[model samples]
Target: MQATKRPDFIDQQYDFAAYIRNPEHNAAPDGIETRRMAIYRDLFYNNIENFAASAFPVIRAITSDERWHAMIRDFMVKHHCKTPLFLEIAQELLDYLQNEREPQADDYPFLLELAHYEWVELALSISEESAIGEDVDPNGDLITGIPQLSPLAWPLSYHYPVHRIGPEQIPDGETETHLVVYRDRHDAVHFLEINAVTARLLQLIQQNVAASGRELLESIATEMNHPQPQQIVSVGAEILLDLRHRDLLTGIHNIPER
Candidate 1:
């Protein structure tokens, strides 16, 4: 028997392609082609594909198997995501669908919006950045005229009504929607349907751009255009306190510290 020469191509990369397609070429060191390699390959790809597909099941269910396989293959080759957790694959796919601005933009106009909507549920579900807010000496008194929003809370609005968009409810055209994705005390995911004005107010509060509770309320009232602005301010103050109680506001910090 002739000795087979080792290829120069072996490097740091795991050489998954060779392992999957040409397992005989690189047999196990024990001199037998173990069934474990095929098992591993099937599980690896299937796990990733299943995990990613689960996040966007509605989209996946509608898509043909051929399209899904092609899409996943393209993603596998093109994207070099950082996280090993299968759950994060949805995020990377969402980012690729959203931020990929090129000639191919027309190919998937609503794709970005859909992906964004899909990511909302997953984002709130698996977010490791838990609530870091602590109670002050005076819980209610600490709520001065200023309040800070939580680091984990996100207020997002999308051009497409995501909550309604599924295989069943998908309309002929895109519809706008507003969403607030936040983690509760139990670390459970919660979604809220907030109005555009409220969403904007939450956005400003989350970004720390609006310094004081008064500023947030005034901005909201001005943007929304209510009859009495000061009246809204008092109402907004109560809302801010409610948000604080919900752990939505971390604490009132200086504008510079934000």
Candidate 2:
């Protein structure tokens, strides 16, 4: 049998992979030929690591710096993400926490929501497409006439008030927050605190239910034992008018188009 001879490419590629993963693996190439390759590999990983660190300051703040760096190192080794956008890195971290990380749900049930809420702000700001609400009649009764929500508007209730989430305020048990997240006519993001009834009403209108704004208000009033559709609509219409003035209504026109 011929004597075994190591291929040059095998040695180079081995050094390349190791140098890429960590600088400590740098072995003298016995020549200046391979030194430049190792330097380039280290620089590439450093740039990537720095970018990830900057993109996720809140997450980084939640962990010790050493732990944070270690976390990023392991993540780089294990996961292959599809997006090159640094803003999307939080999404990947969230997915990892949900599927792979073992953070206790009782103590950190809101971790996922916090990440998502933070990401939402960035997502809306960078979205390439935008939409504005359709024509709406402010004088029309909402409970009697079906009201349509803006396509850019959303009502989201999270298990935790993620806006308040941080290392200091994170509760030891589950919490909930009711919020309306929407984009205005100028495409700026706006968030509001809303009650359960209002959130449900928005959901119903968004689903294109036949109930009019006045009818919905009356239902809310009845639940509170007020039982007056007209009064309820009067108050609800004022609220809807404010939302419309703010461009939160996609369309509020009454039926029959008069």
**Judged by TM-score, which candidate is best?**
1
Enumerate residue pairs that collide in model 1.
none
Query: RMSD of each candidate?
Result: 5.9, 5.6
> How do the residues 66-164 of candidate 2 rate in per-residue lDDT, one tens digit apiece?
766666665655566678877777667656655666554333456567666666666666666445435666455555677877766768889777666
Which residue segments of model 1 deviate by more than 4 Å? 1-15, 18-41, 99-108, 134-138, 141-143, 223-227, 251-258
- What TM-score would every model get versus the actual structure? 0.74, 0.71
Candidate 1 lDDT by residue in tens digits, 1-258: 999866745431346554543344544333324576668657767877888788987678666788777677656655667787777888888766655433242233456676776787788778777466554222443224356666667777777776666666655676667776777777777777777666776777766543566777787888778889998788777767666677666657543443
lDDT of 2 at 68: 64
Where is model 1 poorest over a 10-residue stretch in terms of lDDT? 136-145
Clash count per candidate: 0, 8
> lDDT of all predictions, in order shown?
0.66, 0.67
